[model samples]
Structure formats: C-alpha cells, structure tokens
Target chain A: MSEMTLVEAINLALARAMEDDPDVIVLGEDVGINGGVFRATAGLQTRFGSERVLDTPLAELLISGLCVGMAAQGLKPIGEIQFMGFLYPCIDQLVNHASRIRNRSQGRLTCPMVLRTPHGAGIRAPEHHSESTEAMLAHIPGLRVVIPSSPERAYGLLLAAIRDPDPVVFLEPTRIYRAAKGEVEDNGEALPLDVAFVLREGRDVTLISWGAMLKETMAAADALAVEGITAEVVDLATLKPYDEVTVLGSVAKTGRCVIVHEATRTGGFGAEIAALIAERSLTSLLAPVARITGYDTVIPMARLEQHMMPSVGRIVTAARKACQFS
Target chain B: MASKKMADGGLPVVARFEVRHRNYLAPDGSINRPLPAFASDANLLVSLYRAMVLLRSFDRKAVALQRTGRLGTYAVSLGQEAVSVGIASAMRSEDVLLPSYRDNGALLWRGVNPEEILLFWGGDERGNHFSGPVEDFPFCVPVGSQAPHAAGVGYAFKLRKEPRVAVCLFGDGATSKGDVYEAMNFAGVHKLPVVFVATNNQWAISVPLRLQTGCETLAQKAIAAGFIGEQVDGSDVVAVRAAAEEAVAAARDGQGPRFIEALAYRLGDHTTSDDASRYRQEAEVQARWREEPIARLRAFLVGQKMWSKAEEERLAAECHERVEAAVERYLATEPRRPETMFDHLYAELPEVYAAQRRELAGEGDV
Candidate 1:
C-alpha cells in the first residue's frame, strides 16, 4: 500500500498496466521525456522504454485516430489529450471512428483504447486548461466516460478503463490531482466501471456528483450531518452507461436528491441524473430534484474560477431545500 | 510549383524532395513504359482484367437494384474499377485493407463476397462483418477518415515486427481533409508499413478536384507528410497494379509509407441519389467513357490475341450470372432484429441500456 496523490496513483496504474500487458502502449504529447504535464506518466518511458511509451506529434486528431488504428490492429493504446479543452480537435476521431468502430464493424473490429484527459477547474490555469465538458463525451455512444474523484478510484478505474474492450474517455479531475491523498494498493485490482460508488450512507437526502465536484458534495453531506439531516453521497464515476439502478435505488430510499456538477446546467450530466430520478423514482420522491451546476457561459479565467465551480454552500443549500419538502 | 536549390555556404540546407508520376499504358491501349515483371504474366494480367470486368458488371447491377428499389442508395465505382482492382491485387492475403465507400471492387477482390458488400448497401449492419480476413476494416463513409486507421494498423505491424502492410484507399477529395494530412504525417514520422492509395476520381459528390485543393498533383500531398509520392493513370490497370505492387512491397520491406494518386474520372453519379448531369457536361462524360478501364483492358487483351469477341461475350455472361447469384443471396437474407441495435453498442450492455432494451423488446410490434 502506498499513500499517493491522484496524479501519482494514475502514473502507478499506467506503469502497472504496461508491466502486465505487452500489448499496452502509452502515447501522447510529452508523455515520454516530460512524463506528461501533470507527470501522470512519470517514469513510464524509462521503465517501459520508448517503444512502448511513445511521444507523438502535437496533433490531437492524429493521436486519436492513430490510437484507433493501433487498437484495431491488436494493440491496447492509451492516448492522452493534455486537457479536456484540447479534446475538441480529436472529437471527430472519437465520435466518428473510435466510438463507432465496434458497431460499424458489427463486432468484427473493436477499439480497445483509452483517451485520458485532465478535467474540471480549481488550479487557476489559463484558458482551455481547466474545463469539464464530460457531458459532450458521455453523449457519444459506444464510449465509456469515466472520472475518478480520489486517488484510489483513479488507480482502480484507470486500470479498468485501459482494459475495457471498447474505447473509454477517462477524464481525470485535474483539480484533485494533489488536493487529496489516499492509500492505493499496488496489487493491480481494477474497480468495476459503469457503476456509482456510495461515498457516504444516509437516508434523508442523496448528494449525487462525480469528478472534482465530489469534494464539495462530500463536504455538503458532512455539513448536512451536523445539521441532523443525513445526506447520502454518491460518486457517479462512470457517466455513460450510468448505473441508474444504483442512483434510482438510492433516490427511492432517500425520497430526495440533489445533483451537482461543474459543467453548464443546460445540458449537464446532472440534468440527466435529475431526469432519471424524476422519471424512474418520481412517486418515491418527496421533493423535485435540485441541480447545483455551473452557469451556461465560458469557464472564466483564474480569478473568477471559484465563482463558476459548484461550492459546498450551494450543494448544502440545495440538499436542505430538497429535504425541506415533505 | 518549382523549387531551386543553391548553396551559398549558408546553414546547410535541411531537406530536398520530389514527387514522381507513373503510367505504363497509353490512352489508346498501347504501352508507354516497360511493363513491370508481374505485369508481363498473362495469367495474372487476365485475372486482374477479369476482376475489373466483374466489378463493372456488379456496379451496373447494384445501380439497377437501387433504381428498382431493391437496394438502398449505392455508391457506384464506375470508371474507377482499375484503381480498386490494382490496389487489391497488390495486397498480400495477410495484409489488411482500410477501404473507402467506393472501393467495392477492391473489397470484392480482397475476398469480401459480393453479397456482403450488397448487404452493407442494403442497410444491414451485418454487412460490415467479413467472412474473409478478420483484420480488414469495413467501408468508411466519411471522407479520408480511414487513413489514420491504416497508419495505426501499420504502427501495430511495425511494433509487432510483422511483415504485413496496411493499405488505405480514398478519393482525391480526401486529400483536402485534415484527417488524411494528419494520418500521412503520422505515417511519415513513424515510417509505418502502410500504403495510402487515392483514386483521384475527379469529383467528390459534386465538388471538382480543382475546387478541392490548389496543389498541382494529389500525390504531392505525401511530400508534406515526408514520404514518397507517385501518380498512376488510374484508367490503366497495368500502371496502377505496377505502382501498387512496388508501393506495397516497399511498405512491407519497412521502407515506410507510400502514397499513390491514381488519376481517373467518375463516369457515373457519385451515388444512386446523385444526378451528375446537373454539374458535369455530357461532352466531358462521353470523352471519359472512351478511356474507361474495362474497354482499355479489352483492347489490350484483343491486341495480344489472348481475348476475342467470343471470349468477351462468354466472360460477360459469366459475370452476369455471378452478379445475379450474389443479388439473389443478398435479397434472400433476413434483416437483423431491431433490438440488436443495442447489442454491438458496447462489450456489455449497461443496466440502463438493458432496461431500455427490455422496453424496446416489450413493444414487439415496434
């Protein structure tokens, strides 16, 4: 067991994946010599050699399309898009090629590739550096959108994402890269994807969120506990193929739900979760689902960034409002 | 475009490059250059001609089927049969093909049965599943999108130390897309074992080659990617086959990727839904028909006393029979269940999708 940050945990997972499967390759911009901007691939190039750890040209489209080609030819390629904002150039490859390869080939060709990118805002970075637009990716069928909120989940879920048969967009929350630490065993166990993890058990109301917003949501739950309102906290790790069963069951028991995310409110994944709760567990709900999300505007630069992100106060207020009804 | 290099003892000039064009057959079915050794074999040349003939027949039948409402919209490979057959003939049985939508001739030559290709155009997903080589990708509809996939396949071969090469076929318009440029760049830098063959069919739907790019030749696009570029008279199967053979061999031998621009004209509408008469003139179309691939090959075969009018008639009858059989088989196959749409979406259906799938099944009438 090793206590590591989320970045270290991800690096460990990548190293372990490369060690286990000879077919697994790591490719991206500066993934080799620089060990990635966040050092998520630190020491991988030296440990696995340049053949396995490739530093591709600064072309996101090529990086994505190249990974698809490699995956179809029997190599498990893990491609990294430096940031979530930089993923726009490669959306064509992901949506048209990677996501459709399996269905388009009718199961003959499968893209066993992982596109990893750091998402969310917190670290006062420049424009296009700290944006969380996982909803756009999750909307693409045949793609598994996964985000890790903690070090242990990052290690486990990243390993699972790499091993998944289909293509996966693994969105690593950049805000929590070093904000938190936990003991992630190097035993190489991959946690199950397409399911939500219950971070805290409660009965009054459920706080649903994923990625960096989990920090505020969990804090809200703790704050609600002190107020004698037990709020259950759920981390929806995998956005696509969402574990609706888990969310629905929790909402059915709690009879109240508050969905939170850092993406815009209009088409945010939180709206999907809220809609599912209303559609599937409407009769069991004591109040209408509350969503605490970012405004529909560009994620502002460093100074005004905190105001754009979902705060614990907002989440707690939403949870309290949901609990107040019935 | 022209370039002049002069050394004035400045910082040593970094690079110099050139693009080559190849054509072995003339417009009048006469030889322009010495035939490559493989092209000299009568049996191999006849077999290639036979494939092109069969493709022309299949293409006509497919278009007829579409017009008769027996099949969905079809992309005709008219006037470009030699390009497809040549690229396919150059590929070894083990090498993989990443073909575009119009490369039905190449797909058929690569062992994908005519029925499977028909099924794909017939709006069936199962058509993508090939019973032949399991490694080859299905027909890519998006322009120039499959180029990167070919690069990746080549990268895999290079990584595994495999002798196989990956061949990508697209239209001239694809060279304008960034996908192809990025793929070419990747292939060039990695020196991947891949061949990018572009059939410059003169038209992408309605857009002419002149409007697509300002480059003098489509083959020169490879120069930007740092690879050898060659052009072939696409109407001459002999020339295309020779260039494809050398290119595929070079790739297999780890000489890196080679780009071949086969110049031809689209004789038919881009697809069943298009009306080429709206954009192109008949005089131009009539002139191209005289230079189409099948007739050129027939003239060569007759000149060599290897084929006669009687043999041509017999071959036409045989091609008709083969195409008819494939159509019958395609029409007889049943469509997949609607619920099966959810089947291949993922390796395993998530609970939410499974629930929606159950809902879909519940409405059996749907």
Candidate 2:
C-alpha cells in the first residue's frame, strides 16, 4: 500500500495494467516524452517503451478513432484527451463507432477502449479547460461513464475500465487529482463498475454525488454530523448504468436525498438521480429531493471559478433543508 | 513576390514532387499501354468483369427496391464499380477494409453476401455481422471518419509485426474532411501500413467536386502527408486493380502509406433519396454513362475475344438471378426481438440495464 494522489494512483494503475497485459497501450498527445500535462502518465513511455506509450499528433478525433480501431483489432487502448473541454472532438468517434461497434457488428467486433480526460472546473484554467459535461457522455448508450472521487477509486476504477469488454469514458476529476490522496494498494484489484460505494452510512439524509463533488459531499456530511443531522454519502462511481440498487436503498433508508454536482443543473446527471428517487423511493421520502449543482450559465474563468463550483456550504445547506423538512 | 525572389535564387529548391496517373484501358476499350502482370491472367480479368457486372445488377435492384418502398434509403455504387471491385480484388483475405457506404462492391468482392448488404440498407443490425471478412469494418455512414480507423488498424499490424495492411475507401468529398488529413499525417509519421483510396465520383450529395476542394487533383492532397499519391482511371478495372495491388504491396513491404485517387462519375443520384436533376445537368450524366466501369470492362473483354455476346447475356441473367435470390432471402428475414437491442450493447448487460431491458420486453416489474 502506498499513499498517493489521484494522478499518481492513475499512473500506478496504468503501469500495473500494461505490465499485466501486453495488449494494453497508452496513447495521447504528449503522453510519451512529456508524460502528460498533469504527469499522470509520467515515466510510462520510458518504462513501457515508446511503442506501448505513444505520443500522437494533436488530433482528438484521430486519437479516439485510433482507440476504436485498435480495440476492434484486439488491443486494449487507453487514450487521453488533455481536458474535458477538448473532448468534444472525440464525441463523434465515441458515439458513431466506439459506442455502437458491438451492436453494429452483432458481436463480430467490440471496442474495448478507455478514453480518459481530466474533468470539472476549479482549476482556474483558461476557457474550455475546466468544463464538466459528464451528462452529455452519460447520455450515450453502450458507453460506461466512470468518475473516481479519490485515489483509491481512481486506481481501481481505471483498471476495471481498461479490462471491460466495451468502451468506457473514464473522467478523472481534475479538481481532486492532487487535492485528494489515499492509500491505494497496487494489488490489481478492481472496484466493480456500475456500482455505487456508500462512503458514510447515516439515517437523516442521503448526500449523493460523484467525481469532484464527492469532496464537498463528504465534508457536508461531516459538518451535518455536528448539527445532529446524520447524512449518508453515496459515491456514484459509474454514471451510466449507475448502481440504482444502492442509490434507491440509501434513499429508502434516509428518505431524504440531496444530489450534488459541479455541472450545470439543467439536464445534469443529478436530474437523473432525482428522477430515479422520485420514481423508486418517493413513498419513503420524508422531504422532496433537492439538487445542489452549478448554475445553468457557463463556468466562469479563474477569478470567479469557485462560485461556479459546488461548495461544501451549499451541500451542507441542502442536506440541512432535506433533514429539516416535515 | 516570394516566387519571383525564389526564381532569382533567393531560396534554393529543396524538393520536387510529381503525381502519376495510370490508365491501362482507354474509354474506347483499347489498351492504352503495356498492361500490368495481373492483367495477363485471363481468368482474373474475367472475374473482375463479372464482379463489376454483379455490383451494377445489385445496385439497380437496390434502387428499385427503395423506390418501391421495400427498403430503406440506399447508397448505390452505380458507375464507380471498378474503383471498389478493383481495389478489393487486390487485397489479401487477411487485410482489413474500412469502407464507406458506397463501397458495397468492395464488400461483395470481399465475400459479403448480397443479402447482408440488403439487410443493412433494409435497417437491420445483423447485416453488419458479416460472415465473410469478419474483421473488416462495417459501412461507415459518416464521411471520412473511417480513415483514422484504417490508420489504427495499420498501427496495430505494425505493432504486432504482422504483414497485413489496412485499406480505407472514401469518396472525393471526404478528402476535404480534417479527419482524413489527420489520419494520413499520422500514417505518414508512423509509416503505418495503410492504403487510402479516394473515389472521385465528382459529387457529394448536392455539392460538386469544384466546390469540395481547391486542389487540382485529390491524389495530390496526399503529398502534404509525405507519401506517394497516384490517380487511376476509375472506369478501367485493370488500371484500378494494378494501382491498388502496387499500393497494397508497397504498404505491406513497410514502404509507408500510399494514396490513390480514382476518377469516376456518380452515374446515379447520391442515393435513392437524392435527385441529381436539381444540381447537375442531364447531359453530364449522359456523358458519364458512356464511360461507366461495367460497359468499359465488358467492351474490353469482348474486344479481346475473352468474352462474347452470348456470354454477356448469360452473365447478365446470372447476375439478375443472384440479385433476385438475395432480395428474396432479405425479404424473408424475420425482425429481431425488441429486447435484443440490449443484447449486443455490451458483452454482458449491466444489472442497471437489465430491468429496463425486461421492461422493454413487457416483463412487468421484475
């Protein structure tokens, strides 16, 4: 077991996957000699050789399409788009080819590839650098959208994403890439996908979130504990094909749900979770479900970026409202 | 001003490049020059002629089916049969083909059944599950997107040290897409074993070739990627096959990627949904029909005494019979189960989707 940040955990997991499978390849812009902009792929090219860790030309569509073709040819490719803002070009390849290869070919071919990108705002970067549009990706069928909140989940979920038989869009929370650290055992054990992890069990309200919002959600749970309002925090590791059983069960027990996310509120993934609770666990609810998320406006630049992100105060206030209702 | 200075020795010439054009058979079905070695094989030339005939027959029937409201919107390889059939004929069975919607001729030559093609245009997923050349990609509807896929396949072969090559086919309009350029550039950088064939059919839906690109020839577009690009007489099967064979062999021998631009005309509307009369003139279509691939190949075969009038009639009848049989089989296919939509979505359906699949199947409250 080693204490590492989320980015370091990602590097460890990639090294482990490559060491285990010869078919595993890492390719992206600056992934070879530069070791990635965030150093998530540091020392990978030297260790695995330039063939396994390739630095492709600056073309996101080509990178994604390459993964589709390589995956179809039985090579497991993990492609990285530098940022979530630049991942739009890859949506064409992901939606048209990677997401539907198996169904389009009727099981004749499959795309076992992973497209990893740093997601969410709060890094105070330039325009189109900190956007979190997980909802748009989650809307794509035949794709598993995974977001790991901590170093531990990042390590485990990344391994699972690489080994999965279908294509996966693994969104690493850039806000917590270095902010969050945990003891990640390099034992090659992958956390199951399409399942949620119940971080803190409580009875008053369920604080549901994924990715970078988990940090605030956990902090809110701790703050709410001081006010005698115990909150259950559930990390929705995989957005698409999310673990409904765990979410509904948590909502059923708490009877009050507060969904938090950094993405804009309208059409956000939080809306789906809210609807899920409304449909499945409504009768058990003591209060109406609440969603604490970013506004519908564009994520502002550095000086005002913090206002655009979901803070622990907002999560705490929402949880308090959910607990105080009727 | 810059060119004038360069001419006055301000800048020395660093590089010289030229694009080659190949034409084995003239429009009049006469041999224009010495033929390639493959053209000497009478049986092979006859097979190429037969494949073009079969593709034309299949295309006609498909259009008729779409017109009769029996099939979905279909893209026909009407006049460009040589471009696809010729290139496919040169490829080994182990090679991968990333083909566009109009490359049904190539798919057919690669052993995909006519019924499977019909099933695809007929709006069924199972059609893509090709029993022949299973590794080859399905018809790519998006323009120029499959170019990168071919590069990736080539990269895989190179990484695995395999002698196989990947061939990608697209239309003239696809050359303008950034995806195609990026793929070619990447292939050039890596020297991947890839062959890009652009069928210059002179039309992209309602757009014309003049508006599609500013370059004189689409083949020259490949020169920017640091590779050899050649143009071929697309209506002449022998020319296309010879060029494709050379390109495929060069790529397989680790000589880097090669690009071929085959000049043809869209003898039909872009698809059954399109009406060329709105954008193109009838006279142009008529002139192109005289240069269509099937008739040109047939004329050459007949001139060489390798084919006869009776043999022509028999081949046409056989092609019609085969197309009709495929249409019958396609029409007889049963619709897939509604729940099967979730079947191939993944290797194993996640539990989160299981209930939804069950609900779609009308299994209540599972």
Candidate 3:
C-alpha cells in the first residue's frame, strides 16, 4: 500500500499496464517531455521509449481516429482528451465511429482503448476545460464510463479499465487530482469498472454523488448529522452501469434521496438517477427526489465559477430539502 | 431481419439490384475471335481471370448465405471484381492495400482467407486483424475516410526508407469527400508512395456520378490536390492492370501519389438487398453490360488463341468448388452468442462492468 493522490494512482496504473503489455501505449498533447498539464503521465516516456509514449499533432479527430487504427492493429492505446469540453471536435470519430465500431462491425472491430481527461469546475478552467459531461459519454453503447472519487478507487479502477476488453471513458475530477490523498491498498488490486462503492451508511436520506462531488456530499451528510438526521452516502465510481442495486436499497430504506453532481441539472446524470428513483421506488419518496447540480448554463471562465457550478452549500441545501427542512 | 437491421442500426447494405452481363466466355464456351487490347503471357491473363472468377463465385455464395439467413446483409463486389482484382494483381505482395467496404476481390487477391473476409463482413470484430504476407487494412466503411490512412501507411514506408507502395481503393463518389483531398495533398507534399484507385461504377447509393461532382472524372480531382490523374476503361482488365502498374511504380519511386479512375459499371445489385430499378433504367443496364470487362477480356483472349474451352470449364469448376467448400466450412461453425457485443474492449473485464453484465444476464428481473 502507498499514500497517493488520484494523479499518482493513474500514473502508477499507466506504468503497470505499459510494463505488463508492450501493446499498451500512451499519447496526447504535452504528455511527453512536459508530462501533461496535470502531470498525470509524468516520467512515462523516458521510462518507456518515445515510440510508446508519443506526442501527437493537435488533431483530436485524428488522435481518436488513428487510435482506432492502432488498436485494430493490436496496440492497446490510452488516449488523453486535453479536457472534457475540448473532446467535442472528435465526437464524430468517437461517437459516430469509435463507440459503434464494435456493433457496426458486428463485433469484428472495437476501439478497445481508454479515453482519459480531467473534468469538473472547481479549478476555474476555461470554457472547454471545466465541463463534467459524463452523461453524454455514458449514453454511448460499447463504452464503459468511470470516474474515481479517491486515490484508492482510482488506482484499482484504472487497472481494471486498462485491462478491460471494451473501450472506457475514464474521467478524473481535476479538483481532486491533488486536493485529496489516501492510501491505495495493494497497488496490484484492480477495481472492476461497473460497481458503485458505499462510502458511509445511515438512514433517513440517501445521498448519491461521484467524482469530485463525493467530498461535498460527505460534508453535507456530516452537517445533516448535527440535525439528528442520518444520511447514506454512495459514491458512484463507475457512471455508465451505475450501481442501481446499492442506490435503490439505500433509497428504499431512507424514503428520500438527493442526487448530486457538479455537472448541470438538465439532462445530467442527476436526472437519470432521479428518473430511476421515481421509476423504481416512487412510494418510498418523502419530498420529491432532488438533484443538486450545476445550473443549465455554460461554465464561466472563472471568477464567479462557484455560483455557476455546484458546491457543498447547494448539496447541503438540497439534502436539507429532502430531509423536510423546506 | 432486413427491417430489424435497418430499424435499429448502421450503414445500410445497398439494396439496388440489376445485373449487367459479365462474360469471360461466349455462351459457346469459347472466347470471342478478337484479342484484348493489352496482353501479357497467357498464364498472367489466366491468373487475373481465375482470381476474378473466384470472387464472383464468392459473391454469389455470400448472397445465398444471407438469403438463407446464415449471414447478414452482404455488400457484394460481384460486378466490381475486375477493378478490385486487376488493381491488386498489379502490385507486389509487400505493397499495402487500403480497401473500401466493397473490395472483397482486393482482399482475395492479397490472399486474405475467404473465411476471414466473410467473418469480417459477417460481423466479427476480429476479422480485421492483420493476416497473410501482404498487409491489407480492415475494410473502411465510412465513405472515403480511409484515404488518409493509406497516405499515412505510405508515409510510414517513406519514413522507414522502405520501397513498398500503398494503394487506397474507393468508389467514384468518394472523390468528393474532404479526406480524399487531404490525403492526396499529404501524399503529394510528403512525396509518399501511394496510389488512389477510384472504381467509377457511378452511384453513391442512389445519386449518380453526374451528380456526385461536376468534374468529368474523379481522377481529375487528384490534379487539384497536386497529383496525376489517369482515366482508364474499367471494363478492360488489361487497362486497369496497366494503369495500376504505372501508379504503383510512380509511388514506389517517390514520385508521390497518383490517382487512377477506372470507368466501370456496377454490374450487379449493390448488395443482395438492392433494387436498382428504383433508380436506373433496365435499358441503361443492358447497354453497359455489352461493354462488360469479362466479356471484353474473353473476346480478346479467344482472338489470340491464348485460352481454350477446356481451360474455361476447368477454371469455372475450380472456382465453384473453392467457394462451395468455404461456405460449408463457415456455416458448419457454431453461431456466436450475442453477449460478445460487450466482449473484448479492455484487455480484461473491469469489475463495474461485471455487475452490469450479470444484471443484463438476468434480464427483466430488474
């Protein structure tokens, strides 16, 4: 076990996978000599060779498209989309092509690679850098979506995703990449890609959150404890095949739920959770299932970002509303 | 199944059906008394003819497999066999081929296993993996998008100082796509050894060649991208072979990319499901069939006395047997389970996915 941050966890997983298979490779902008803007791929190129960790042209479509060719030729590539927002330029290749290659080829070809990027709004990133659009990617078939909340889960899940037979959209919350740290048990243990983790257990209200918002959800849950109301907190590490079993169980017990995320409320993952809760456990609801999410507007270029994006205050308010404080 | 395939997903299998006759031998089983305009040894012409017949026979079998519900809606290269085979035959084994969805003949000419080709188009992702002595790219389905890949492969050849040329094959409609122009420019700027062969069978699904672009020929489109464009009689296999040879040599010698347009008719339904009558006239089809490549070749060969009736019967029997055996072997294999849809993305299955996969396995229980 080793103490690390999400950045280190990803670095470790990349090292291990590349060491294990010659076919596994890494590439993107500034990933080479500069490591990366986040330093997530630091020291990899020197440890391996330049051929394995290349710095490619600024064409995201080509990056996504060429990776399809490389992966088809049996190379396991890890592609880094500079930012979640900037990934738009390559959606045709990623969505119309990459995500459907497996099905379109009738299972003949797949883009069995990983697309990793830093997302969320805490850092005052530019317009195309702060979006947390997991739902957009989760909607695509033939793709597994994951966003680890801690160093431990990041380490395990990264390994599991790297080794998975399907392509994965792995998003890391930039706010927590270095802000949070923890001991990763057994650097070799790989967390599977599809299950959610229960962070804490309680009763009255169920709090569902993931990625960078887990910390805020925990904070809000702890605040609700002072009011003599216990809350169950669940971190949805894997977003695509969300942990409905654990969530439904918690929601059933609590009779009320608050789905929280930094991403916008409209058509966000929070909506899906709310819909699922309404569809499956409507009678168990106390107040309407609440979604504490970002406003349905583009993230500003900083300064007033907190008001634009979701925060612990917003989550706590939503949790209190579900707890009948309204 | 056709409605189901269309109602839910993917690139449509062209459904237009029309057969323009392609005769390698007169009904009398003798080549016409005229000679082919271009010639090599009797053996090479026989080689091209035999390879083309193999693909033609294969196309027939593929359609039967689809009709029997054994295979999926297939995109047949039946009438385009001459262009596909003739172009590929002109190159060396070390040369790379980037073929579009309808170039099964190119795959066969490069020695791809019939099973591999069928398995690929038949709906197996693993079908595109590298195989055999020559490197054939997995099929390019999105129209004309693979042009850059061929250019890139050619660039790799240039970078490594290797002498092999890369040939990119597409249909006439592809000349309009931006990727083609981009690839042409890149090959020209880099002086990479790549040849662009556009099989002008003249329809992008329903839109005819006249509407695809205002240009007289797709080969001319290459000139705008700074490469030489040559137009040839697509039905004339001899012309296609000679044109391919020149393009391949030009690229191999670092003369950069050359575009060759082969004017041929799509002599059959685009695939088994198409009804060409919805668009093209039956009379027009018949007129084009008279200039069919196979018929032209057979006439030329008989005039030279290079081919005989006995050889023709022997080749046809050989082709039929080979296709028959391949079909039996392919169908004899067990059908794959649908769960394979989720298989093989990551090197190993991720934990989160296992829960979902298990939940899906239990269907309706949720």
All DockQ scores: 0.85, 0.89, 0.18
Off by over 4 Å in 2: B1-5
**How big is the positional error of residue A76 in model 2, measured in Å on the Cα after superposition?**
0.2
Candidate 1, CAPRI quality class derived from DockQ: high
Worst ten in a row by lDDT for model 2 chain B: B1-10
Q: State the lDDT of candidate 1 residue by residue for B24-52, as single tens digits.
A: 77767777778789866888988988999
The best candidate by DockQ is 2
lDDT per residue for candidate 2 within A129-244, as digits (tens), equals: 98989999999999999999999999999999999999999999999899999999999999999999999999999999999889889999999999999999999999998999
Q: Which whole-number lDDT from 0 to 100 does residue A113 have in model 2?
A: 99
- Given candidate 3, what's the lDDT at residue B317? 92
- Looking at model 1, the pairs that clash are none
> For residues A185-280, what per-residue lDDT tens digits would candidate 1 score against the true structure?
999999999989999999999889998899999999989999999988999999987888889989999999999999989989988888887766
Expressed as tens digits, the lDDT of each residue in B214-275 for candidate 2 is 88899998899999999999999999999999999999999999999999999888999898
lDDT of 3 by residue, B38-132 (tens): 45478888788888778888888888888888787688765567799889988899887888989988888888778767776566665665354
Supply candidate 3's per-residue lDDT for A98.
Answer: 62
DockQ-based CAPRI category assigned to the predicted complex of candidate 2? high
Q: Order of candidates by DockQ, top first?
A: 2, 1, 3
Query: TM-scores for all candidates?
Result: 0.98, 0.99, 0.75
User: What's the CA error at residue A208 for candidate 2, in Å?
Assistant: 0.5
Error of 1 at B280 (Å): 1.5
* Superposed Cα RMSD, model 3: 9.7
